[model samples]
Structure formats: structure tokens, C-alpha cells
Target: MSIATISTFVTAALVLVGIALALLVGTVGVAAYQFFSQNRRVRVARREPLVGYYRTLAFG
Candidate 1:
């Protein structure tokens, strides 16, 4: 095969590899964000203390 033909094939393969890597990194970033956000919400909920009995429970 001619050198030019081989170079073209290599370039195409590299481009495809770059696109696949970008997609993989993007997916991982999105998943990490969701996981961290949910964890933060759970921590916040756990820290909140109950105020007291509800109005109906109070004799008044």
C-alpha cells in the first residue's frame, strides 16, 4: 500500500479514538455529579433536627 493511504487510515482511526475517549469522560463526569449531589442531600437531611411535636399533637 502507498504511504499516503496508510497515513489517511491512521488519521481516521485516531479521530475515532479521540471521540470515544471524550464521550467516556463526559459520561463519567455526569455520573459523578449525580452521585455527589445525592450524597450531599442525604448529609443535609441527617443534620436537620426535629423541631418538636406537631400542632395537632399539642394540647394547646
Candidate 2:
């Protein structure tokens, strides 16, 4: 009922929300990277130049 108590509750809620957002974003990013990498690999396998280019960029 007090302002101080309400402020504390709001702070805790905001922190939890922030943490949840970070986790969701991180998961989405990882999933996107994997999907793109797989697609790139598939394309590379279907072509020689792309595969070579990817390899050169990765290791050379």
C-alpha cells in the first residue's frame, strides 16, 4: 500500500521482464543462426564456388 513497497514490487517485476526478454531474444537469435547456417551449407553443397568461398572466409 505504501509508495516504497509499490516501488520495490515494480522494480522486481521490471527485472523479471527484462530477464525474460533477454532469454527470448537469445533463443530466437540462436535459432535463426542455425537455420541460416543450415541453408547456407545446403547451398554450398549444391554449388562449388559458394562452398569454396564459405570455407575461405571461415578459415582463410
Candidate 3:
């Protein structure tokens, strides 16, 4: 085989490997974010806060 042919094959292989690595990293990042960012707190507010009320506080 010629040097040019070998170079082309190596380039293609490297590109494929790079794409796979990028996809794997992106998937892992998204999964980690979802897992670590899980919100277990109860998000329901019983009532809305009044305009001048201090006791009633609305929160997520």
C-alpha cells in the first residue's frame, strides 16, 4: 500500500473514534446531570402568598 492510502485510512479511523468518544461523553454528561439534579423535594404549594402576608411563603 502507498503512504497516501495508509494516511487516508488512519484519518478515517481517527475521525470515527473521535465521533464515538464525543457521543459517549455527551451521553454520560446528560445522564449524570439527570441523576445528580434529581429533585426529591415536594414541589406543591398549598396556597399562594398574600400581597402583605409574612407567614405565607410560596416556593418550588
Candidate 4:
């Protein structure tokens, strides 16, 4: 094959690879954020009532 044809193929392959990687990273990032936020909310929900009770006992 000619040099131009080979280079064109190489360039197209690289672009496709880049797009795939970006999509993969974005999916993982969103999953991680959701996981962490869900965990955080659970922790806060479990703690909030205890905190309010303490504040009432201490200040009232």
C-alpha cells in the first residue's frame, strides 16, 4: 500500500481508540460518583438523628 493510505488508516485507528478510551473513562467516573454519593447519603442519614438528639440534650 502507499504511504498516504497507511497513514490515513493509522490516523483513523488512533481517533477511534481515543474516543473509546474517553467513553470508558466517563462511564467509570459516573459509576464511581454514584457509588460514593449513595454511600455518603446513607452515612449521613444514619448519623443525623443522633446528632440532633445530642444537640437537644446539650442545649435544652
Model 3 vs truth, CA RMSD: 9.3
Q: Per-residue alpha-carbon lDDT of model 1 for 1-60, expressed as tens digits?
A: 999999999999999999999999999999988866666555566664223222222353
Each prediction's TM-score versus the true structure? 0.70, 0.70, 0.64, 0.69
> What TM-score does prediction 4 earn?
0.69
Off by over 4 Å in 4: 45-60
On the 0 to 100 scale, the lDDT of residue 26 in model 1 is: 100
lDDT of 2 by residue, 15-44 (tens): 999999999999999998997687787667
Global lDDT of model 2: 0.84
Best by lDDT: 2
Could you arrange the candidates by lDDT from highest to lowest?
Answer: 2, 4, 1, 3
Candidate lDDT (C-alpha), each: 0.72, 0.84, 0.64, 0.80
27, model 3: CA deviation in Å? 0.2
Error of 1 at 43 (Å): 2.4
Candidate with the larger lDDT of 2 and 3: 2
Compare candidates 2 and 3 on TM-score and give the better one.
2
**lDDT preference between candidates 3 and 4, better one:** 4
Question: How would you order the candidates by TM-score, starting with the best?
Answer: 2, 1, 4, 3
